[model samples]
Target: MGREDFERMARAGFIERNGTVVGDYDPRLLELLRAMDLAADLPELWDLFDLMKAVPLLVVRGEHSRLFSRETVATMKARHAAMEAVEVGGQGHAPFLETAGLPEKILEFAQRFASSVRAEAPSS
Candidate 1:
């Protein structure tokens, strides 16, 4: 967005500054922006409630991360009943990169989730 447009949106309460919200030069920023622009407050998925009801969700958190709070996790669970939250041990924002064994932990979580998904499927 142009500076003028962004400024106007900010003034109108449609957008606000997200100061250093993510790690510096986080490549995920662009992927996230492409998926959904937080500044616009746009709804990427129209039937979010419906989808939430149909799917299981896992929310992993860094123990010391400031990006999301306990309240946010609670709200997320309230919104989607099938949500699971995991906290990485002894780390802060971007713990998966900062802490040792993080990759293993994440991979284990993924494997378990996948196994559960397959188990839940109806047998042909």
Candidate 2:
């Protein structure tokens, strides 16, 4: 984004700036954006259940996010019975990871997953 845009976002509380320089756009990032636009129509994404069945899946979503709707989240939970989900209050599109309580919640989830794995492992 341009300097003006960044300044406006900072003023509006969308982001916090710590005197960091932020103007130049990366050519590689532009290329990746183009590639993502070209690959937007991904029908096979619905078949992720087969690949993710054995893995611990966590879906942390912003409550007001426009990209991932509530219906989609429900469908995902229906497809993957073991999926864990959490909604960050009063956030849209994306939640700032540095928000209070977010780190503690993630740590708790990780610890629970590790304990489950240890319990399932066969004794030597």
Candidate 3:
């Protein structure tokens, strides 16, 4: 069922030409990969979810994303009653927040969850 959608994403016609970056592909690609090896000491943050349970949670995912699967989203929703999840259609791996109506959705979420709270000005 998702084959046509997947193929549409793969075809050259699917790419937005105006957004294309004209570059020498190979060397920059190698540099990007090499940069990852410099981060051996990065801290693991998978358990941070437990710490965030006290706050309202919002998860935005790409419909075609392999890294963040629907099953994982379902499990997270099952665990957190306050969690809100939305999948942006026709996107993969990561959706550009500026492209989709993501900014509006995120803004709505913030209003719903945080509008009631106010930060007090610090005493001088």
- What do the candidate models score in CA lDDT, each in turn? 0.65, 0.76, 0.74
Name the lDDT value of residue 17 in candidate 3.
53
- What lDDT tens digits, residue by residue, belong to model 2 across residues 15-98? 334866554445587676776766457566877566797788888888889998889889888888999888888766666555
Q: How do the residues 27-49 of candidate 1 rate in per-residue lDDT, one tens digit apiece?
A: 66678668875677656552565
Task: State model 3's lDDT.
Answer: 0.74
For residue 42, what is the lDDT in candidate 1? 50
Clashing pairs in 1: none
Q: Kindly list the per-residue Cα lDDT of model 3 for residues 27-107, writing each as its tens digit.
A: 567777777967488665547766777788899898989999999888788777789998988887776565578999999
Error of 1 at 4 (Å): 43
- Number of clashes found in candidate 3: 0
Query: On a 0 to 100 scale, what is the lDDT of residue 91 in model 2?
Result: 68
Whole-structure CA lDDT of model 2? 0.76
TM-score of 3: 0.57
CA deviation > 4 Å runs, candidate 2: 1-20, 23-27, 36-40
TM-scores of the models, in the order given:
0.47, 0.70, 0.57
